[model samples]
Target: MKDDSTEISARRRYFRYAVFSLTALLVMSLGMAIVPRQPPAPAETPFSERARAAALADALALRAAGQELAGAAAGDGGPGTDTALDRTVTLLTIQARALVLPGDTPTASAGTGPGHRTAQASSAGVPASPGNSATPGPASLSELATDLAASGATRLTDALEADGGMARLLAGAGAAQLLAAGEIAALAGVPAAELPGWQEPAGPSAQPSPARGCTSAGPSGGADGERVDPGTGAGLGAALTATLDAEHQAVYGYQAALTRLDPTAATQASSLLAEHLDLADEAETYAALQCTAIPPTPPGYVLDPAFLGAPAAGLARLESATLTAFGDVVALSAAPARGWAVSALVAAARRTANWGVDPGPVPGLTLDESQLPALPDRPENAALTASPAAT
Candidate 1:
């Protein structure tokens, strides 16, 4: 009887222990249910990265707007309008393709032109026109002009925050947009002064240090003096010197061309010549700030006999060549030097146009249009061709 009683006590102890464990587990689960768990916070995007994405998005939108305008022009406007819109579209396409992220593969499709995503109707304070719709309607020329100017202004603002290579591209793109804006405005009979003007942004007071392995002293000396090698790693100093060299050539070209030009053309040439002289002085000041050796200007530059024969065409070619030098300055220097370079680029491009030559899509960038990345496939843009403005 005592053995049976002890066995019952053991069973009772085991039952109590099981009950205690179950109660504790229930209490803990209830406690857990009452407390809220927090989720992990998202990582912050860097400003430079954000700027790049914004630029890409803007490029896409501008391209779409250009396409819309082209279509409208085709239906109602004259051939001149069609031509201008086509060129503008081409420029926007190149910019959009260039702005694509390094590793993000664009959608592949046969004969795909500049891809159009369903982006915001307006970006960077630019108002959306009727053309931004999914089923876009015809837009007025005046509205298109306003959009281009605002878009260009936004690009310049973004350029201030982008990396070196991107900054250069953005500056060029911005200048192109502004140029197109003026052209479109002219077509619409809008006053050029009414459009947005290029304003230099505030930036680092001091220039960034030269690239690693670069020295103030250049690789080789010319007959004039120790010429700064404008090669890679030569930094802003070399770039400025190179630009000064180009300016020197431009100055000489204008002087030579002035003699051959008609009286009216000569008057304009003389004004431009004075401007070139001022530009040369400005380039020298920047070079001196960098401690780069400035070479003496040659007494004369070699001019093509054909160039001498047709001074106007030659002047256009000369102005176009200066664009590369200015672009290098845009890439290598920070503001306000970069701002200066951008202005120079715009002026040169306009001058090229003034001389009756089209600056092609991109003025500063020498691109092989054939090798540029094909536009990515977007379901929304299935109906768009690779060149919406083509013939």
Candidate 2:
């Protein structure tokens, strides 16, 4: 009888232990269910990095195309091959400097900028190979134009706006790319009229006085105003005035286009008109801060007859002209002013593309008209070339 009692006691102890273990497990699981876990954070891309990557991609593509062009030119002795190659090299060199390499200053001049990614290659005074590695695959001239018009200028614009030593370098580099892209587009057979500013007028070097017989005169002072000290002004006063005048022309052109455009096209025209007006206002405000005279808006601007019925083409031409003026501003302005001009130029190129205009090989710079085939003689077209006035 005593042995039977002992066995029962042991069995009871084992059953209790098993129940306690089960309860503990259940409590633990419930606690775990009640608590939420935090997620891992996402990685952020640095602004400088993003800008450098975009610029590197284009530099590679441009260098590859340039090599092919050089080869073809060498084999066939083409007339413009050397010119194209030279421009390509100059552009690539500037882009190489804009790559945001370690130890590079953001404000370095493109012409004398330093970079480490291709420091060795650059030291040799050659177009640094793309990525400081083997050349990328071939890119056609048309492909280059498309790439540049699509993203190159805008990417550089971003870099130009970023804070630091690099932004200044990007401004110069970006401007050069805009000029080269337009020139290349023209060479690729894009219509001359399609890229109004792509081809340089006969006497681009001559800066006419805005005061002389100023038909399209504006508010404060004219382009004829005396030159200020380059050291102190960085040419901001003159550049701001020029840009404001261009903005006025843009506003007027877009306004005229809005009246004739179809509903869909009219909306785009209206938006651009407002944008130009805002830009004009901003320019004026900046001029005031600098104590410079703001040019007044002209009474009327000249527009092509074609624009009266079909606004798209006319608006596009005006945008191209504005783009040219901005490029010139970039070339002449300093630091912040140049950065602003770069952004404006990028926007203008985008607008021109929207209006059925293909940004030529060089979107912003004027090319020699001789390179293009002559257009059919139109006396009316003379008005288009007669003056760089309002229209």
Count the clashes in each prediction.
1, 22
The TM-score, computed over Cα atoms with residue i paired to residue i, of candidate 2 is 0.44
lDDT of 2 by residue, 361-382 (tens): 3455544444433222212101
The whole-model lDDT of each prediction reads 0.68, 0.54
Candidate with top TM-score is 1
> What's the C-alpha lDDT at position 31 in model 1?
92
Report the poorest 10 consecutive residues by lDDT, candidate 1: 382-391
Candidate 1, residues 89-145, lDDT tens digits: the string is 787788777766656433323422332222233333332211223443434677567
